[model samples]
Target: MKKIGIIGGMSWQSTQTYYKAINEGVNDHLGGLHSAELLMYSVDFAPIEQLQHNHQWPQLANKLSHAAQSLERAGADCIVIATNTMHKVADVMQENISIPIIHIADAVAVKLKQKGIDTVGLLGTAFTMEQDFYRQRLQDKHGIKVLIPDAPHRTCIHEVIYKELCHGHVYPDSHLAFMRIINELHFSGAQGIILGCTEIGLLVSQSDTDIALFDTTFIHAQAAVEFALS
Candidate 1:
């Protein structure tokens, strides 16, 4: 198995999800007690969260890059940053290392293609939603159309991601809010809703909505496990 590195703890809750899913997938695929061989550099969420709140991309890149370098030096073959918003600085993180960065969007697109989802509604932080790196990659590289909730709905989604999900908390009200967003996106033109934020699944889930839901966190975990095993 390949030694995959995870740069995580953008919120520890989602990082734990990655760790669990990766291990479980490895075991399932190998048909035994196999577990993923991984190097994890878990950054303290407070500093990263502060930078996120301030829109300080440069500082975030520096910190995350340093963490990536450390994981590389510790013998990780490739890296996966566990949060979607953290991927904003992924380019910078990759620049300082020889290892591949298993980008979340790229992994997500592969699954979307497998499912034949042409148009997807995205739920992520404001930066990830507005950023070109993610949406453009899905469009240009994967030939998929991306949709996002309208401004008001996006704000509500973002609030739930940060205020509740990050802490491993869930509220029915939050799920209901996301259900509304899913409805809006489906009405506006989306074949499925992609939970672009790793933590958002803590609230919204497949059982909660009628629109097709693409859980990026779950897909990302499955992809990481596949990469490590292959």
Candidate 2:
């Protein structure tokens, strides 16, 4: 198996999920005692979060690029930025490293295409939802239509992700709120829902929604495992 490098700990909460999912996926594929060959460089989310709020993407990119370089130096065969929002700097990280940075959106897009899902409802950090980096990639590259919650709902979703989910605080009210938002999107013609934030899977799952739900954390990790084993 190839060594899979991860730049994680944006919150440490979702990084845990990535680690679990990747190992579990490898074990399920290869059977008993088999697991992923992994290397991880976890960052403190405080500084990164501040940089994002300040709109200092250059500095943020530098920080993530440095992390990717460290993983490459440690002999990682490929890289996974464990958070969906952090993928804003994926190109910068890839430019600074030799190994591949498997993108979360691209992984999710492939699944959507395979399932014939043309339009998807996206829930993530404000940047991931509002920015062109993610939505444009899916629309332009894969011919997928991406829809996001409206202004009010988007604010609620973003706040819940940072203030609650990222810190591992999952409340019953939050679950209800998310379901309401998902239902609204479903009515708005969203064929499926993309849990674009890594921590979101903790709050909502396929069982909670009637429409198809795509957990980016699982898709990203599964893609990494496939690349590693190939």
Candidate 3:
């Protein structure tokens, strides 16, 4: 198996899920003591969050680029950025690394298509919801339609992600709020929901609602495992 590199800790909470899921996936596929070959460079989320708030994407890109290079030098065969919002800088990260960057959205798109889901409701940081990179990729590359919560709901989702979920705090009220949003999206023709933020699965899951839920963290990790095995 190839060594999968991870740029993680855009909040250590969700990175933990990526680590666990990747190993579990590999074990499930190979059986008997098998686990992923992983090299992870976990960064402090505080400064990166601050840079995002200040619209310093170039600086954030530089930081992630450095992290990717470190993983490459450490003998990683490919890279996975653990957080969804940080993928805004994926291009920069890829430019600085020689190995493939397994994009979270592409993994998600593949799953959506496999489930015959044409339209999906996305929940993530404001950057991911309001920006075009992720949405356009799904639409253009995968022929999937993406739906987002309204402006007020978008703000609430963003707040819950950074303030609560990223810090490992999952409030019951926040859980209900997300459910309401998902139901609304379902009414608006979303065939499924994309837990676009990696931390979102910590708050909500497939059991929370009847709608199909795509957990990006799990999908992305599984994709990494498949790439490694291939």
Clashing residue pairs, candidate 1? none
Per-residue lDDT tens digits of candidate 1, residues 61-180? 999999999999999999989999888788888889999999999988988888889899888988788888788889999999999877887788777777888888888888777788
lDDT by residue (1-230, candidate 3, tens digit) is 99999989988998999999999999999999999999999998899999999989999999999999999999999999999988998988888889999999999998999999999999999999999989988999999999999999999999999999988999999999999999999999999999999999999999888899999999999999999999
Model 2 misplaced regions, further than 4 Å: none
Better of 1 and 2 by TM-score: 2
Worst 10 residues of 1 by lDDT: 149-158
Q: What is the overall TM-score of model 3 with all chains considered together? A: 0.98
Q: Model 2: per-residue lDDT, tens digit, 150-216?
A: 9999999999999998889999999999999999999999999999999999999999867999999
Alpha carbon deviation, residue 149, candidate 1 (Å) = 1.2
Task: Give per-model TM-scores.
Answer: 0.96, 0.99, 0.98
Provide the global lDDT of candidate 3 against the true structure: 0.94
Clash counts for all predictions = 0, 0, 0
Task: Give the clash total for candidate 3.
Answer: 0
User: Which lDDT values do the candidates have, in the order given?
Assistant: 0.86, 0.93, 0.94
Candidate 3: regions farther than 4 A off: none
